[model samples]
Target: MNALMLAVALATHATPVSLEDARARSRDNVQALTAALQASSAEQDVRASRSSLLPQVRFSAGASLNYIGPQRSYNVVPVEGGGFQQLQIDTPEVRYPFFNLGVTVSQLLYDRAVWARLEQSGAQLEALRGEATEQQDTSELEGINRFYSLFRTQATIQVLEANVRRSEQQLERARALFQAGRVGKAEELSALVNLGNDRIAVVSRQSQLATDQARLSTWLAMPGAEAVEAVDPGVLTQAPAPAPSLEQALQEARTRRPLLVALRQRLRVAELQESIANAGYLPRFSLDAGYQRTGPEPSVFFGQPARQNRVNGGLSISWDLFNGFSTQAQARRAEYQSRVAELNLQQSERELEGSVRQSLVALQAQIVSAELAEANRKAAADALVLAEERFNAGVSSTLEVRDAQLKLTQAELTLLENRINVEIARFTLMRAMGTLAPGEAK
Candidate 1:
């Protein structure tokens, strides 16, 4: 109740919104924003992987204190030619501080594994982007659905309110007739009961409208105190175009569907992973070089700067040869995953075909339903007018007029619902074909 009051207060000063505005508001939606952020993170992964293919350089420096113990030696020279004198020598203890600095650079001369990993990262990034697009599309479609629902519910509430007013008028007329002895009390009572029923229907419809508005608020990312008033949008009255052939739709879905594209990229990533694992069986070559200075203090090699100054470089090869069959197992697992990706891609394609077909069929059915509902509404309106006239002429009772009004109210509501359904179905078809987006249909 509090939320409803707050919404009503906020809505009082708000302008009505259209379907396009609803779709645009979805750009700020939490789901869409989160997906976009994830895509950006994936792009960074691509950059990091590319960096691995470049040369690496690092610097190191260290300092330490050392202690040296005394050294003692004793020697006897073969008895010193039969007059051997034993000689003993002892060296004093010493301590020194040592510091050194070095820089090392390494570059990959040949490594198929690193190259494959770079490719795999690129494929994974592509898949992430596709998934992000799918999230965006899904969020937009949900917003559209909620907007239409709120609009339809609001319209129904208006119809119920109008019905209640008509019932009240009929009750007044019945009361006048009973007082004049032209009608009995039962007729007036029946009219009063109907007015009560219409009032109850109005209350029920108002509750439903409130619920629908709350749901739309969430999709629009509005605060609880803010309410959205979705106007007619004008799309409800527009007729849908003819659906494309089934085979054409299937082809388009296979090519355009985000999930299918993402899965295909995943399959490529898995294949690259397999290549990377197999690369372990081959020798890797690299070039590494370093410069070092050793002295009493930290210094690079300059003239008379250090006791030892050295520049070293080497070209090295590494071969795992055998490592407990780990490489073989990894390759096997990647192969299995590759198969899984392939199956996933195929499954998405099949489902897309089915979804597209089903939506098209449903769209046609809704179009027909809307036409029939419009016709029914017109017929009910004519009957209501004729029954009202007959009652006024004393040729019919209030019951006939009441039944006609009820039928007309129900028919009007049905027409509104059917129109909204047709629009929803058309959008659903577009979504299934991977073409649903803001401003596209409009």
Candidate 2:
């Protein structure tokens, strides 16, 4: 039956999508893309923070006009010649246009606050990366859910159509028996009613399938109008794996979940923030150097002999003595925020453990249900066959056959639903354990 269904599905779909394919396409989901952009922005922030520790270079040029008053001469008496003499000594030029060009470089030698901020930015970058992974995993899980929903609806439609065909045959048989005087008009009417109900069910399932297909298409970042066909994941045909212990699942979740990891990184960032606030009590050190050239004209600014060259270097230190208690307030705020982060981490861990337990229990129950549903389906099929034989032998009424057929159809749908539920539960468990991402071990 599985093989037949697979063959029919392949023949009908021009391109059927698999679970892995759906997960792969989830990278294009809006949330995933947004997370990626956020991570990229955080990376730039880290670079900006680190740049404060590196050398900064700048170039400057300017020109200005100058003015000075006229020079005055002094009269002096010579000791040997008893006569007054006017003495005019050489004087430096006082009126000139000035042109200056300079290059300056500055580097931070020591700054505790700057260093702490750099570390905080690095932690933020890591936290954002983990968040991006978490978003990608979430998107992939959503894609998986949509794929299975579409697959289940498609399979249910097939079962309903088959039931309709069976009803048609029953209707024909009843008509023949009535003409032969073996059965009354009531049997024919009942068979007709059954056929109508089956057709109605098929139509309902078809509508659901269309909705599911569109949902999957939109999630996979395809055109909204495009139809998506899902290939069966074949979970029913395979043997179920042993369930993991709740403790083991919790351990894995604690170590592997991106959300938890991101939270831990945020805690580190908060601690670094506290450090940065406390660093206000420490002095900062830096190095600065510059070379300048001045001339009376723009052309001579770059000339060798006409330019007055200057080279200077210095070390700087700055310490904040007081800021109206702002630093103390900031430190207190940072300490409280760090405590909040710690509390959040604790709460998240508890929630994660609860999720793991619930998922594991649900998965185990679904697996058992799938097994029982398969057995029920087989029994229903056998019962339907017996009822049809009895009806042909004239020992049973068409109503008996119709009831058996309905039971079989219902059993088939139940089995299909249980099988799909088992798969969904397993994926949910994997997600809880943070192993749902593509290429991760399940």
Candidate 3:
């Protein structure tokens, strides 16, 4: 099948795509990219949360102009050697400019909520990473299924075409025998019918191939008219490696499956959220320091000696005290969420165990089927040869030979199909066990 795909690719001068290429292309899959982006965003959230534990510095500057109206002033002026006299004066209008520049620094001395949030964010990031990996695996599997399905259809078409050619040859022989009076009209008619059926089968197989190719093009993100050829991985003909016992597979899945790992991380994240919620009942403390300069001009920040300059530092604590029972309600909700996460993890484990068992059984059954199919194909080939010899020697009828030919074709197709099925089963079992290679498409 792989050879056929490569041949088609070479004949058409189209770039041949292998399973590895499909897996690589899966990196650009939309769902995987979205998960990766989510992971990246979560990482930023973690950084932002952790930043609360570090000192933060901010610098600010402002300038304002104030206009003042004329003011009346009262004063007592003293005479040279007499009593003081009262006087009145009107002051001119004036404009005043104010400017200030300051830098403020704050550090989180102790805040349980911020610390809990940081921990939660880290766990969420890990969960998103796992999700991204899952999406990648899913995309790869989708591409692989499409590729192999197309391969299967193409192979079937090849078989049907060969069958049609064989039937045509048999029909010609039947017609010649009929004219020579060695066979009757019925035999020739039967041969014609067989040839027509084989042609129909070829048409059906071709249609199936076209459909599979169209689906594969969607996975490859190519134009509808683009040709895609899959590399034959030779998995159908190769003997698979020994699989582990059911118990071993389950154990491996428990430790290695990305979904399980991600779920565990989510559980931890939920626990951290609960902690964060409970933290609302506790007091938060921090340290703050600032330096400031103020004057009538922007230059007062640096050059004006008359500018007021000051530095201040302080420690602060905030206790929520009460918020109309909202804090208590949040704590309860978080605890409930934690419980739900635990339950979900348990459910996932149960489902995963079932899947592993089912896949193992299916793989074992398909292996047996492949062995039987091979034996059947050999028997059918022998039968066809014997029947053809009998017909040539005039010891048996053409109907017997035609039946044997049909049986041989069916047996060949069955063997090939079963071989592919076994390969698919092997892949499924590996996926269930969480042991599939990173680069290999499912």
Per-residue lDDT for 1-442 in model 2, tens only? 4434543543354357898899889866999999999999999999999999999999999989998766666768575558667777655558778888899999999999999999999999889988888888899889989999989988887888899889999999889989999888998999999888877776656567768888998998888777678987777578677688888898889888889889999999999999999999889999999998888875666656544889999999999999998999999999999999999999999998989999999999988988899899999999999998898777899889988998999999999998898888888888889887644322
lDDT per residue for candidate 1 within 226-296, as digits (tens), equals 56689787754666566677887777677677777778899999999999999989999999999987776
> How good is model 3 by TM-score?
0.88
Tens-digit lDDT track of model 3 for 320-395: 9989999899999999999999999999999999999998888888888888988998899899889877876657
Rank candidates, lDDT, best first.
2, 1, 3
Give per-model TM-scores.
0.87, 0.88, 0.88
Residue 272 Cα positional deviation in candidate 3, in Å, after optimal superposition: 0.2
lDDT at 414, model 2: 95
Off by over 4 Å in 1: 1-17, 65-95, 175-185, 297-307, 438-442
Question: What is the Cα-based lDDT of residue 391 in candidate 1?
Answer: 73
